[model samples]
Target: MKKISQKNDKMTTVSLTQILENGIWQMEAEFSNSQYYAAIGIVRDTYNIPADTHPGLDPHCHHMVSYGMSGYQWGDGAVNYKGNRTEGNIAYKDNQIIKAEYDSEKGTVIFSVDGVQQPVYVRGINEKVRFIIYMCYSQASCTIRSLKKLIAPTTKHVANEIAVQW
Candidate 1:
């Protein structure tokens, strides 16, 4: 794990992680503010570290899912990067845990707000997906509270020769 920070402590921050195949990935972020914006992104590659208050992913191609005072959307590259609202819902808001859990075995990613699953953004994301947490526009901020990656459980075949006890 690397110690990454936002370019400006008062405005915005970007935290990125490499998604490993055959593993389960989970990231939790704490957000506050009603006028500013907080969002999450999954990129095919790493974003330029130490993002400023500019409020968008630079030098990286990503699929973004934003949830907060700014509303919700699924976009490519940045927050409201397209200037258009897509089909999505505002999953959560101030002082809540926005979580992302990835299952490599199923090639699926799940987003939840305060432990309640929202919806699966999309399937078949790259095995090496880049996870990003960002907040921009206005004086709001977001913190990457926790990030963990665990090996997916494996199933073992049992032989019928083993006696069964009821």
Candidate 2:
């Protein structure tokens, strides 16, 4: 588990070193002092993190998809992102678990709060991506609890036996 805390007022974004490309992956994080702004999501591996800006809201960048604890989802860039407060009304409180799952096969990213899945999701992601977390206000922190790849389930067919009467 890794904990990321911000000491300044500027929004700070942090991303994992591992890049996920063609598989199903899941990440779970816990936020503290998230009353103001704290977000968890994914950013393209090629995205360059700005000095001080939200990953999803960075005007100069358009390769991010973020879900905030304040009940909002952001995709691409601030200019053409898809989401708002009303669409993602599942606000999370401090210490609540936030889960993000990405399926490269389906080209979708989904979010869940405290085990309950949210209706809002981001799609059309076919490139390599990395998990990211951001915090704005001072002393705001997020702890990455787990990051793992889920195995895809396989399908099987069974044979049925029948009895014939002569």
Candidate 3:
């Protein structure tokens, strides 16, 4: 692991593997002062990246975005931004996503996410559904964990997602 800073020297690395406990992959991010915090994003046909050359399909596609959360002007935090039709071609805005696709028979919810253009074989996400995927520029600093361990999982008030598991 690499040290995050010269001041405190916190080791840092984002896990590619889902940290599933009961049966899901849940992420929660919060804010403090919000100059910019550590963040990761998957590139796709969106974000001005060309479709054919889009990193959404590439396993090595990881980018960085930013946000300022001091005053919560953007409601700045981990966002799963979605665009509306009247907002022109791109409708989704920046948001924090807490979505899940569960298996009724197997009794397991989706523990992974579809990279930008990568085909997801989730139980419900069919190929026809459209999702606007984007990157995190800058964001607040907060501990994010699976909901099984959440003391208080954020709701739609400050967070945004497609579906809620609970």
Candidate 4:
């Protein structure tokens, strides 16, 4: 487990390792006591925490997906990119689980909270990936309580008692 703390919003940090191909990567995280906005997800290049860059808005870097206190968005760029307000306004609080499943062959990405799938899906992202954690303002803390990777089976295993509908 690794702990990352930000006294003020000036820099962003990325994981040293890259995500595995055809695997599901998950992390259990806990936000700090700050009332400000924070974010966590997979990112490549880094950007200055938005609140420090611009007031109110916490813009995301291009080619990443993050679930922040404000909302969840994905795309490419430092200032302008593709994103949307996550459905249900799902935000991470003191403790929550963030999961990302990458299908290398399909070039697809799926994000989830706890165990339920988040509607944010990114396709055609066939490049290597890394994890990122950041905040848009001062007084924020985020901890990666645990990290795990599950390599999904290439083929399905069916029991003999099961009937094949097809």
Candidate 5:
């Protein structure tokens, strides 16, 4: 696999497969935009990682996130997809999925994003997905340690027990 160290908060790097998949969806599928992202699905049904179980990895761990299972169309588009702009080859921005709900009576799915659940109707579905989990450090040292442990077979995917943000 490839790697890009010396990362930053906003400097989000996506997987190679993700980039390629996004390209295909943008061209073939009637998606809102040329890209999509699915990150919040990291925990699946859980709300957040519990504080007690969070522990430090072995001396050799390396990497922040463990592997995950996800199916596309992931990610909120980097732009605002207003309406059926994808029709007639028009363009709508890819948006994020803050929340998803099923409407019983209306027989429609609603997207709760940024704070509102808006209804959307898409023509097709793109199901290229992957899974991701966390192996993290709140600081650079923790990240470094985690990366080191990843090289060792005996080590496992674990986060720093403490959540310190400074």
Candidate 6:
């Protein structure tokens, strides 16, 4: 497994090499000893954001979705965009698993803590995107547990009909 570390005083952002366009993709991450915030989300593959910049804070990249410490979710250059909030004001704890799932077909991205899905989600994303993470303080580190494409569930569409009286 490859590890990325930031031992400096400046904030840093990192992205995965895989590009996700269609179908559902999920990434699970665990943060340790982080200060300020450790953020995880997805960004457009074509965006040219600086390594020291936070993708959620970039006005040019408004489709990004990120969840960080203190139950904060940032997307479309706005904090808690659309009033989405985490349950119980959760904060980043050691070895706490945070999962981010993106469904391209639905043009939405949602985050979950451990296994419970959060209430907030971002929508209207139509571009190919890559998974990204941000570290805001020195000695902060993250472990990407898994990144994989999920099998799309097959469902049959059924039409509802109402009986009409003559």
Query: Which candidate leads the pack in lDDT?
Result: 2
The residue-by-residue lDDT of candidate 4 on 75-116, one tens digit each, is 121111234333332454545665555555655545555665
Order the candidates by lDDT, highest first: 2, 6, 1, 4, 3, 5
Q: Candidate 1, which segments miss by more than 4 Å at Cα? A: 1-13, 34-36, 46-86, 151-166
TM-score winner among the candidates? Answer: 2
Q: Candidate 2: where are CA atoms >4 Å away?
A: 58-61, 71-86, 153-166
Worst 10 residues of 2 by lDDT: 157-166
For model 2, how many clashes?
Answer: 0
Better of 3 and 6 by TM-score: 6
Candidate 2 structure quality by residue, lDDT tens digits, 1-166: 9888888788788888879887888888998886646777787898777777675554623666666665323422111132232243366667988888888887777677787766666667878989888787788888889988889712111233111110
Model 5 poorest 10 in a row by lDDT? 140-149
CA lDDT of every candidate: 0.50, 0.67, 0.25, 0.49, 0.21, 0.64
Q: Each prediction's TM-score against the native?
A: 0.61, 0.79, 0.26, 0.62, 0.21, 0.76
Candidate 1, 44-161: lDDT as tens digits: 4443454353333333323343333444223321223323333343446657877767667766556666766553344565546656666544545566787788665222222321
lDDT value, residue 104 of candidate 4: 59
Report the lDDT tens digits of candidate 5 across residue range 118-141: 233221222332212221222211
- Higher-scoring candidate on lDDT, 1 or 4: 1
Q: State in Å the error of residue 73, model 6.
A: 10
The regions of model 3 sitting more than 4 angstroms off are: 1-13, 16-18, 36-59, 62-140, 149-166
**Clash count list over all predictions:** 0, 0, 17, 4, 25, 0
Clashing pairs in 1: none
**lDDT score at residue 166, model 1, on the 0-100 scale:** 7
Runs of candidate 5 exceeding 4 Å displacement: 1-36, 39-97, 122-166
TM-score of 5: 0.21
